[model samples]
Every structure is written in structure tokens, then in C-alpha cells.
Target chain A: MAQPDMTRIEAAGGRPEAIRLETLRFAWPGRTSFRLEVPEFRVGRGEKVFLLGESGTGKSTLLSLICGINAPDRGSVMVDGTALADLSAPARDRFRAERIGVIFQMFNLLPYASPLENILLPLSFAPDRRRRVTDPRAEALRLTGALGLQDDLVTGARAAELSIGQQQRVAAARALIGAPALIVADEPTSALDTARQGAFLDLLMTQAEAQGATLLMVSHDARLSGRFDRVLDLSEIAMTTRGAG
Target chain B: MLLPALAWQSLLSRRITVGLTIFAISLSVALFLGVEKVRTGAKASFADTISDTDLIVGARSGGVQLLLYSVFRVGNATNNLTWESYQDIAARPEVEWIVPISLGDSHRGFRVMGTSAEFFDRYKYRGGRGLEMAEGARFDDLFDAVVGADVAAELGYRTDQQIVVAHGLASFTEHDDKPFRVSGVLARTGTPVDRTVFVSLEAIEAIHVDWKNGARIPGQQVGADAVRQMELTPGAVTAAMIGTTSRLQIFGLQRWINDYPEEPLLAILPGVTLQELWDLIGVAETALVGVSAMVVATALLGMAAMIFSGLAERRREMAILRAVGARPWTILALLSLEALLMAALGVLLGMALLYGGLFAFRGWIDDSFGIYLRITAPSLRELWVMGLVLVAALVVSLAPAWRAYRMSLSDGMTVRV
Candidate 1:
């Protein structure tokens, strides 16, 4: 594992925090009974944090807000010192593509695309991210090799043909491409066994650290929290009472 | 550009569904084009049947009826025009040439036309193209006959072959006693003339001399040789094709023939009567076009239904795309482009099928229906139809595209499915 380079973080921004939220409020439209409120949340720059929550605890909603997929009702979502509310919908999508990389729990790759194609999908959406890599295909090949994906599997096999563990590694490579400032993983290892989960987390964290990026992974399993720098419970962060699951 | 590539790959992933949908659309397209081709081909061939003739003179009756029986040989004439009337019209200074035609006889399901020997020189078809013999010379002997291309080919009749003409339009009453020798076979004309057998007017009068009232007398029979020495000038004829010396004299000559005091004779401009006949059949053509258009609509709607139903299972795919920084509009464009590609392929395949079918069936259609389907490049109207189908496909695709857009927006990186 490569060590984090402090010079890159200082060049990106002098600020100590990677993500900050203040007085956030959100609710689903036409569903008046459920609401989520958070007073404050922060993740430091180059930090590896674990967010623990069961299903139906607004774990996905918080990730959506941080990625700018959904706008908060009242407060601001600021990632890498840029306020998400200040941007238009398309700009927010571009901002997410350039600054944030996300890995879903399962089915993180397009089934029909080859593994190399899935790894380079983000560059297709973000010109800024594409400009960061001088040779996109070579960069994708390097990332796939670092993630233990064989050249034949990356080139010849479709994403659907790979095992679940291989798919998660490809998804991790996709998330870490172009050295995005933030990495958000939503139970990325939930389908893996305990041994593979720890091994996958080690690779993901090492890749994030090498890029000087912050990792925020949300999972229901508490046993995986020991490896992270910090852990936060969703029930403690969200100040509102649970209305409906 | 990347989105269209993605769309293509996505469509290729589900080959069976996409292939079935394209097959349905292509079949409908082929049917639509086929109907349009037949409609235009029928009209063109009908208009090309006869040309350069000023007027068709027959007994006083409907103009369409006169044109049908005299030119198409489709039905019997209600009455006959006297030979005196024909001679009177032919003597007028405006008449350049006149060919007398006598119908009401058959030879093996082919109409037998009794005409003057000069008919070969005066009659014209397909834009003033003169008749040319394929085998031998024109009829000269009293019992000599000539056959059209189709008649000769279909019945295997060669020059000098003897054939018995039957009285009336069917084979029930045969004039077997007076068999005529085939003198010539005309070249193919791609008209109703190709289906007729021709003989000199004297032969027709000789065959009917002993017959009375559509039947033969009990003991009266005329030998083929004995009748050759008698006076064979026909007293009456079914109709005549007349050409004028000047184009300006056609209407005047037609009016004079219609108002002649000798008999109730009708004269009609060939072009005008042909238009009237076509207009009468235009209603059926319009109905056929309408039915084919509906079939196209149905096929397009089926494609819409197929894509719309597949969107449900694709919710997770949409979420994955959204998570990778694809906007809702990107998903919308991707689905719409997939449908457009399918429609374009279907159209191309349909054109190939249409031309292939036409090339395979051209001869059969000409022989069976007398409609010469020219295998030419697609007309502007046909290209416009394909363009309209693509537009329709784009419009129909919006339904599924809009649905996927909404799904990607709402699902937003975390679809439950």
C-alpha cells in the first residue's frame, strides 16, 4: 500500500475537513410521516470513516445528500469546500463525477460492459476527471492490475460474467479512478464473507490513502469498524425521531 | 456520442427481444411498401395499355363499358356497330386510319379477336409502339390466324399450327369444323393485347355463317374450303379504334360519330375514359393504403410496449448509471437512441425484403395480373414513408424514455430492487 502524499492534500485545499453539513433537513415528497434532521456532520481530509446503521435508518439518504444526488430541504451539503446548493442540477452531477466516487453494495457495474469499460465510465461523464489522466486506458489498466483483476478478465469478460468479489474489486477501481477527493461506499462488501470483506476493505482504504482521498463507508456490521480511523452511528447523528421505516 | 454507443451495446445485450421487435416492424414495412408498389404499378400499366389512338367507337353505351370490352376484352358488347357506320366514319377527312375489331369468340380461354389485316399496321400500344411479329408474317389467307405473345407462349402455338375457334367467350361451343392456321406470333407488349388471338375478319364471318342465334343448325354446315369462295365482308363489328390526322380534329370527329343518323354509336377519347375507370378503382386503393398504414402503427405501438415493459426490470441498471454520474436526461437519451437504431435497421431490412420479393415475383405478377411491376429504386414517396416511420418510432420511444428518466431521478443511486 502506498502512503498518502500530504503535498497533494495541501494543494487541493488548505481546509482540514473533506465534508461538512449544518442543520440538514430532508423528507420524501408526499410522505409526511418520515423526516431526517442532522445538526452537524464532518469528515476530516484524508480520513477513513465508518458510518454504522441498519436498513431504513436513512443511511442511503445521507449518502445521496453528500453525493449531491438529492438536495437537502433546509441546510447546505459542502464537499471539498464547494457548496452543493450553489450549483445547478447538471453542475451538481458534474461536481459529483469529478470530486466524489461511489461504490454500491451490489451490481455496481453495467452488466453488458467489460471490466475496463466500467472502470473508465466516470471519465466519460466528467471532463475534469478525464483531463486528470493523460492516458485513460493505461490508467484504467493500472487500476485494474492494482485491484488484482487479471488482464484477460478485464479485457475479455463482461461485468456480468465475473464473480461477486471480482465485481466489487472492479467497482472499487471505478470509484478510485482519477483520484476523486471523496470515496463513498454503501455496504460495498456486504455480499462478501468476513475474510474477503476485511481484505477488500484493506485494498479500498490503501487505494484511497494513496490518492489522499477521504473514505466514508456505511455498513450495518459493527465488526468492520475496528479498522477505520473513526466510526459514527446514524441514530446518534440524525436528531429527528423515526417516523416510518 | 458515448451515450449512443452505450445504447447500441445495451440493445445488443437483449438480442432476442430486439430482434423480434425489429422483425415485426420490418414485416409491416414490407407490406406497406408492397401495397404502394402494386397501387402505382397497376395505375401505370393501365395507362400504358393503349396510346396514340384518338377515339374508340362502339354501340351507344356507358363510356367505361365501351372502353372495357373494346380494349380490355373483359365483357360482351351490349350491341354492335354496323359496318356502314364504320365506313362512313372512315371516309371523313379527319380520320387517318381505322381498325375494325370483332369479338365474341374464344380459343382455349384466350379471347379470339377478328380484325382486318390492316389492324397490325394501324393499332398501337405503350406509347405508339407498333406491333412486331416474333415468328412469321401477318395473316393473308382467309383461314390464317395470328397469336399474341402470351397466347403463343401459354398454348405452345408455333407458326402454321391449326387451332379451332369456339363461338362465344367460352369453350362450350367449338367451331371445330373451320380450323384456322396460325400465321404469326406477336412480340410481348405487356398489355391486354398479349392475351388475345387474332384472325382476319373473313374467317369470323365464315365460322358463323351456318350457326344461328348462338348455336349451330341441326343439319346446316359450311365446309372450311367452301366458305372461302363466298363474299366475306362483315356486316357488323363490335368496335373500332380510330386515329385522326390532326389532334385538333379528335373532339369534332367524336361528336360527329356520336350524333350520326345511321345508328346509335358512341365515341370516347381513350385517355378520358381510362381516367374515369381508374378513379372508380381508386377507392379500393385508398382502403388498401389505409389498412397497411394501420398495420405499421400497430407494429410501432408493439415496440413501444416492449420497451416500456422492460423498464421495470431495468430500474437497478438506471440506479447504477445515475450513481456513475449519468443525469436523468442521459438515461432518457440512451433508451430513445436504442429505439431509433432498431427502427432504422428494420427499415433497411424491409427495403431489402421488398426488392427481393419483387425480383422473385415480377414475372408471375405480370403473367397473372397484367401489372408490370418495375423493380426500380424507391420513389420519393416511399422514402418519405420510411422517414415518417422513423419519426413515428422516435415519438413512440419517448414513452419509455420518459419513464426511465423519471425512474432514474427518483431512484437516485439507491434502487430497492
Candidate 2:
């Protein structure tokens, strides 16, 4: 399995695309009416892409597949040059932890933990990510600081005590920690007002660019597409429609 | 370690429910341990009541009955052994020493035991510890009385205080004509010996000189001083405790006493009879232990229910953890860790409550129930019970932990609830 992927990754300038999906087919077991198929999809290294999709359009399902939380029925999901289908379940989880950082639309922080603690949580599970930082606490503080969170709020307040915008910024800092090769955000700015949304996106993009990580953010909002290097519609990428056997 | 920290923080977040669950479990643990402590304490004190005595000779009856009446001062003897039989047993070459006991009297609620002054010298309790006077000397005169510590404390009787003996358990059948002076007060023995009033065998005869058919003869009342002057040889005694010259001769003497041809008599080894008594009442003790164990189980189930119900509200938390790279088993471990921590806390708090209760009520329990509760480290049996409780908690915790594991697996990175 590694032979072909190694050659293909070498063919792609010696550094694999951040995410590559080829002839991907998926369907929730016991739900035969809804199938998702994508002939080809790719995100190059350090590329910022906006994935536009509405609710119930297989957006979360696609993210789950990319994260190796769900296996594809056909073809392969290669993230950072490794084939997810070739790894064991636990190895795939480790791969996700080491190479991909995910931010949810809401409730992205553990309510009991401080923002600084939340930002450092991924390191607690992934030693590879933890090894990338010289000092975990100092790095957490730096990331939160870069995301516009105050030192006091990041250090003292629980994640639940922070405002909505502050919490999203904290989540952004958490997703950007350890310089993971890919950052996947699922409608991360939906909970924020229009002004805060644009500002949060700018800060998030700036942080991603500074880390030189690819960003694949999914949202239905079209106005935010101009800021990304490339934009793709979920309907255009996924060829199968619901209930169309 | 991170899982444990997360579990601790999660528990702390729901401190109210968690605190109440811990308190409930602690209460049950305390009850379970308290029952076990009192059971063993009562058994130890009962066994400690009389030692070094080879046999207790009483009129033919049940061995447990003889032990209850002769040693524990509980219940009435079916019949009394004649003074001649007692003398015959005492004169045996194998007998080292003997003390005769005459019952059927009371001062207030305390049983009045009439025995020779040699009883203070010959009888032993709590592993050969002799009786020590807390106030004055043992009874010497015919009308002199010696009270146990609890009798003196409860009735406020001191050396030289006068007390009239009742004919039996009834308060109205008092031998008011021959009031006895308290000559001594014995120190606390943590046994039934601490609840008795001792008088001379002659004193028992003197008090009943004017009484017949369980009542006083009209115009035949004997004054206390005159009764002391009269011959007071006891015609019969309720029982006698005998010590053999050698431990090897005890069984021989016991057999001889039990087979005495002149009278229907029973001779029992105090230790054997005490064990027999326990065997008879062991059912009640086992029932008490079972009930307490059930209480502990109920409290632990309540804790499991609390955690299981809390799992529904924690789907988002599980999703967040999974999104942060925690495995499904980590979620399972987190729940189990939480349960274990609560159980461990409950056990610690329960021990504190048990020791605290013993410290506060040790004297009162000893006085009221004649069972001494020593403030020492927990026994091996008690530690075993605590260990079992933790194991049970861990076992019960697996139900919810497994549920959480399944939920986290299926709800990967996206929990609807």
C-alpha cells in the first residue's frame, strides 16, 4: 500500500498534497438511499480552500471521512502522504492527531478547562504534536496571544466563561497548535456576527499562513469565499445525489 | 494521568450531585463498618466475661442457660444447686478453688449476686485480670455490699451508701428491713461484671430470714443488725465456678461434677458454653451484617445511576474529547476513574466517621451495652470489606463506562445531544 502512495507522493514534488481524495465512494450503513461519491478532490500543501456546502449535504460526513473517523467504501483518502485506508483504526486516530487539527462550529472547548488548557489538549493525546513544541505551556500562551485572547482570560478563565467570539478564537488557537499540516474548520464562524466573522477569518488565515498549513474550511456562506485561495462547491465535487441509486 | 485529571475536573464540575453521591456512599460504608465493629466487640466482651474458670456448676439445664444466668447475670436459673452439692464439688482433690453464687435478687435494675469474698480473689475476667476496687474494699460483713462500676455510677451509690435489696426483679419485693451498706465499687470491666451488685452469700441468707413464700412474715421482720448476728449459712446456691488444680484435671472434674450421684447438676466449661451461646445467636449477627451489606450496595447503585444519567448530558463533552484525539477507551477509562475516585473518597470519609463515632461514644457504649469499642486501626476483616466495596464500585462503574465508549465511537467528532 505504501509503495504506490510513496511513488505518487514523490511524483507530486516530493511533498504530498495536504489532502487527496480519488474515486471516493461512501454511504452510511443501513441507509442505502443516501450515498456520497467524489471522483477527484485535492488540496495542495499550504493552500487555503473554502468548501461551500449547506446543512444535510454530506459536509460533516466528508470531514469524518477525511479525518479517518469513517472508512471509504471505495478508493483512498491520503492525508500528508499516508493512505488512511492502509492504517489500523488506532493508527489512523494517531495520524489524525499528529497531522490534522479540527475545529467545530460550536462548543469547541471543554467547558471545565481553561482556554490555555484547552489549547494544549491535542498535545496531551499526540506525543508527536507535543514533541514539536519546546515548551507546551509557553507555546499555548503564544498561540492564544496570536489569536487575540488576553493573557488573563487564557490563563484564568474557564472556556465556558469566555464570550462566543473569544471562545471561537480560543478554538482557532487550539486547532493551529503544534503546526499540524492541515486545519479543518466546520462552519467555525457561523456562531459569530458578520463583523466578528470576517475579523476571525482574517486572524485564522494569518495564523494558518504563518504556520504554512493548508486550511479546508466548510461553510454555506458565500461572502467569505473571496478570502480563500480557492473555493469548491460540495454539490459539484460530490457526484452522487441523495436517493439517486 | 491526564484522564484522571479530566475525570476529577468533570466530577468537580458537578460537585453538588457528586458530593451528595459520595455522602450517600459514605453513610452506607459507615453503617456497614459500624455493624461489623459492634458485632466483633460484643463477641469479644462476651468471651472475655469469664476466664481461667474450669467449670460452671449449676442445676441441670441447658448449657447456654447456665452460662447466661451464672456468668452474664441474664435470665433466672431453673433451679438452685444445694449447698451440700457445692461443698462436695469444692472438696474434690482436683479442684483448686471454688466460688459459690446465689442469685434471685436485684438492686434497682442491676442484678444482685451473692458470692463469697473469694469470688473477688478467685474469679477472673478479660484474660486473668483480677477485679480491682475503685473506691473501697470488698464486702466483708454480712450486710456489706460491693457494686460494679456501672451500678455505682447509675444509682449514685458510693462506699457507705445504703441500698435495700429487692427479693427478685420486681421493684416492690424489696428487703427494706435489712438495708445493706455499699462497701466497695469495682472498676469498669467492660463485661457483664460491670453491671452487677455483689454481696456476701451470708448477706443473701440474712435478707431473706423473715421472708417466706416470696413475702415477709407478719411481725417476724428481722432488723439489719440482728440479721447480721444470726447464723447465715446458705442452704442453696444458684451456681458455682470452679478452677482445677491443673489444666489436665479440668475435664475429669467437669465430668465428676456433671455426674454427681446425689443431685441433678450441670457442669460446663465457660469457654465452650460461651461459644455455644454465640452459635445460637450467630443468625442475628449474620442478618445484621447482611442488611448492612445491602445498604452499601444500594448506595453504590445510586452512585452508578447518577453517573449513567449524567452520561446523556455529556455527549458534547465526549465529542470534544474525541475531536481532541482521545480514543474511545480513554473515554471509558475516564468514567471508570471517576467512579473509583468517588468510591475511594467514600471509603476514606466512612473511616473518619467510624473513628469519630467511636471516639465520641466509646464510654457511653461501654457503660450502656457493656461492650468496649477500642479506638484502634481497622482490622483485616474491615479492610477486606472496604476493599470489596471499591471492587463493587468499579464493577458497577463498567456499565456506564461501556455505554460512554460506544457513544463516543458512534458519535465521533459530532454529538447531536
Candidate 3:
């Protein structure tokens, strides 16, 4: 009964799902820690969802477990119908590189690398990062233009040299560079000033929408919930808490 | 993921740590190679000292000390043999020829030896070869002298220059009356003889004629005319070089010399005595090498400590690499590469330090102890040791690499802290 998203839509007369979680038992090993028993969760292809939860609500850990970082003690996580639990560590890393994009909350970008170099990292690791774009510079430029990163910053500016807001944009550009099927941003704008957070999140969601990327953004802010096509709160839907949400 | 520039940047960013590690490694390499270079050179020079001579005979002493004083001029003689005893031994049928030596004096720290003219004809060195003079000839005349190549070259001793005999083993010659003329300069033998001056027995006697108990007896001095009438021969000499006529008769020669009732004497084969000397001095070599190895090992520990200590601080950096799809092993590989690269740099710098140090202080070493250090680029031994040290360093430094691997693996989406 993987029916977490009850209002599933039909794309061209057939149902489509990008992410699925079933009976996922995620927990910290020691400290008699509580575990997250995910009964069910699903995201449709091309969907944008802002997953909101307070601090320590097990949202980040859910994202991690779904991304194949931590294996569920029971049940499974499925990315495009493939069980993440079935994949080996190296294979899991490869799958994430090719199909998934993650933007961390703070210092998400490699500090020493230029903006473009940081963006190009997915291709450096993921074998499938290359699509029709032959020249990485050209692809990077096109993506940077779409994201509205500064024109000068497009040419190899170190990520640490940028402002906090700029680092978020650079990470978004990197997440979108490979046109991955799914992009997850875990409180990506928490460190940015209030004035810049909206702009960065809007840019990230709009770009993922343009690339046909299913976007799942986790945030503690309740106000951002309505901006997404679907909104979910960990306290309302989360069956268990294993780690920081 | 392991681009050269990236590795270079990582190393550059942590320069203080890298530099300190490199410095520690280089110091160990320098000390290790320095000791090896000096020790090997010393052995080569000492072994190369007496090449052709068979035996060294002295007044009943250990073979090594006998060779030490007679050939290397390293110590004073315990006793001297009377001329009558020397002649008795030389007259033996087993003896081929004898090089009777008179010692115990120097001119400015260089040893002076009074020997018969047969020395020039019989003495051999460095592979049974005779001495090759860079400039003059042998000291055949009783009042003539021959200077060694280094002595002549260093002190600028010219042919036909006059020199007087010193009273003790070094400096302040006793006699100014009879100044011996330099007739020849011996070639570089790389032996202690390179610092010695060769003079005849007649010159030794002539210089001491007016002196009693190593002084010009107050008002009792004998004139040069009357000194010629007095016995010009020395009563005794330090030692003699024995060349047996038959190899089978070597034991006979040793027994005969040892059994001589008139004088207590010791017979030593120069070749065998040299082996004994090497055995006696081997302990120092082992101790020196042991200390140097410990120094090198400690430096490697420093490298591991420095890199592993930085692991916690670098967790974020490592996670960034992971997010970009860098495998955990790649992170480990980079760390190991850094360790190995730093060690290699240190080794090269250490070699340079050793060569420079040798070049700066060679003269002092040679002049102080008469040990001429051969300074050259790294030898096969040094290269092999360097390769082994680097390999060991890499293995020991893997602790940091292992830490890096674990960090990257555990840092899934974000840093733990």
C-alpha cells in the first residue's frame, strides 16, 4: 500500500512515481535512540515538494536514508522503482551521482574550487553527467545563465569567496548541472539572510521544474510550505524519529 | 578526482604542517646518509691503506696497533728494536727483505719516518703498486727527504727545500743545524703516508748528534766535524715491515720474530691486522647506524601525527569531495600520496644537505684526524636506503589515510559535527 501521496496523478494515462519509501526503519545504532518507521511516502515525477519540520524532527535523516546513505532496518527506499537497499555502497554512490542531487545547508560548495569547477563536480564523478553538452564550459555557462549567477562568477570563482547566498545558488547550479532526475536541498538557505533566502529557493525550484527534476526541499520554516505543489510536515506524517529531521 | 593541481593546492594550503613534516623527514635522511657516507668512506680509506705489504712487525704488540702506528701513524710506538735485533731477523732465510723504520718525531704535526733506501724499492700500496710521484723522485741520499703528495701540495713544499726534525711526535723540530733537502714527492696514496715526510737513517742520526735526551746538552755540544766521527747509526728503531720470501714461511717468520731471545717483538700480517681492526671498530658503526635509524623512524611518526591530527578539521572538505562522487578510497589515496610526496621531497633535500655539509667541512675533518672524506653524490647504498625509508614512511603514514577513508565514508550527506 505505497500510497503516501493519495492524490497521485496520471501522466498520459499512466501513473508515474519518482521516489517511494515503505516501512523504512531508520535509527541511530547506540544511545537507545528512537527510530523513524516510515509507513509510506511517495513523490511523483516532476513534482516539487517542500518538506517542513522543526529541528530534530528526523527530516534530514529521512533524506539521507532515502538517498541510500543509511540502510533501513526494515522495508525499503525506491528511486524510480529501484530499491536503494539492494545497491552496494559503491553502486549506491554511483546511482546518487547519476540520478540524485543534494545541496547541504551550510558550506554546501567546495570552498577552494571555483563556482564552475564546483558545478562541474557531478560530471567529474558521475559517468552519466554528460548529456548532449560536449563542452563542460558551455554547459556550465548555459546553466549559470539560467540560474542568474553573476556572469563574472561563472568563470571559476572559489565558492568560499562568495557570499552565503551565492554559495546556495552555486550549489543549486551544481545540482542542476547534470540534469539529475531528483534534487534534494536540506535547509539550503538557512544560513542566508532573509532577503536572499526567497530568491535562492525560488531560483532552485524554478530551475528544477524547467529540467523535469523532481524536487524535495526540507526546511524548518513553516511559511515556505505553501510555495510547493505539495507540502508535508514530519510531525504530521513521520511514523518515527531516528535522526535530526 | 586526483588531479595534480588539486593535490598541490591541498598541500600548499597546509604548508606549515607540510613544511614541518618535510623538515623532520629531511633531517633524519641527512643524518642517516651522513653517517653512512662517513663510515663507508672511512672503511674504504682504511682498507685501501696497506695494499701490497704482507706483514708489520713491532716490539711485541697487538697486530692492529702495530699496523696503526707503522702504517697509519695513528699512535706512538710502545718500544723500539735494537739494530742488532733487526739485523738478526733480516738475516733469516725465510725473510725476503726488511724495511727498518725509525719513528717518534714530526714537523708541524706530520709524522716523520727514517727508513733505509730499500724502502723506496720495496714499499708498495693500494694493490701491489709502487708510489707514483706527482713531482720529484725517491729519497736515496742519506741527507735527502721525500714529502707525500698531500703534504707537499697542502703546505706548498717545493723540491730541494730544507726541513729540520721535530723533537716530539709533532711540531717544533729539535735541530736547526742539519736541514734535510726535499728530493722527491710521493704520489697520493690515500694512506697515512700521504701526511708523512720520508727521511733516511743517516739524516735521523745527523739531526740528533748534538742533542742528548732530546736537547743540545748545555755547553757539552759536539761540533759537526766530531759528530761525523761518532757513530752516525741509531741504536734502535720503532718497527720493521716483513716481506716473507715464501708464503709457506709466513708462520716461520712470525714464530722466529716472536721467539727472538734478544728483543721482545710482535709480528703482524698487515692484511690480517686490518680485518681485526675492522672487527674492533664495528661496534661504533652499529651504534651510529642504530641511532640514525631511530631518528628517521621518529620523523615518520611526526608525519603521521600531523596528517591524522588534521583529519577532524578536514571532515567538511572531505564530505565536499564525497558529494562530488569521489570514492572513499580516493580520499585515502590522496592522503597517502601527500605523505609519500612529502617524504620524497625531504629525501632529496637531505641529500643536498649532506653534500653541502661535506663540502663545507671536508678540510677540518681531514686535517683534524687525517681521515680524508670522499664526498660524492648518493651511492647505491644511499639510494637503496632512501627507497626503503620512503616505502616505510608510506606504510607508516597509512594511518592518516585510513582515517581519511573512514571520515569520507561516515560523512554521507553532511559532516557529523
**Runs with alpha carbons beyond 4 Å of true place in candidate 1:** A1-16, A31-33, A239-245, B121-138, B148-162, B170-176, B182-190, B211-221, B245-249, B259-261
* Candidate 1 chain B least-lDDT 10 residues: B408-417
TM-score of each: 0.91, 0.93, 0.81
Candidate ranking under DockQ, highest first, comes to: 2, 1, 3
Tens digit of per-residue lDDT, candidate 1, span B1-417: 788778888888898999999988999999999999999998888887888889999999999999999999998899999989989999999999999999999999999999988888877776688889999989999888999999999999999999999888765889999989999999888887889999988889999999889999879888988998889889999999999999999999999999999899999998899999999989999999999999999989999999998998889888877887888899998889988998998899899889999999999998778788988899999999999999999999999999999878877876866
lDDT of 2 by residue, B213-294 (tens): 7888999968877876788898999999998899999888888887899999999999998998998889999999999999
Clashing pairs in 2: none
TM-score of 2: 0.93
* Clashing residue pairs, backbone N/CA/C < 3 A, model 1: none
lDDT of 2 at B302: 97
Question: For residues A69-133, could you state the per-residue lDDT of candidate 1 as single tens digits?
Answer: 88989997788777788788988888888888999998888898888889899989888888999
Question: Which portions of model 3 show Cα errors greater than 4 Å?
Answer: A1-16, A31-34, A130-133, A150-157, A225-227, A239-245, B1-5, B52-54, B75-98, B105-111, B116-198, B207-222, B229-236, B241-272, B355-377
What's every prediction's RMSD, in angstroms? 4.2, 2.8, 5.4
Chain A TM value for model 2: 0.94
Predicted model with the maximum DockQ: 2
Model 3, position A163: C-alpha lDDT score: 82
Residue A150 lDDT, candidate 3, scale 0-100: 67
Better model by lDDT: candidate 1 vs candidate 3: 1
Q: Which window of 10 residues has the lowest lDDT sum in candidate 3 chain A?
A: A1-10
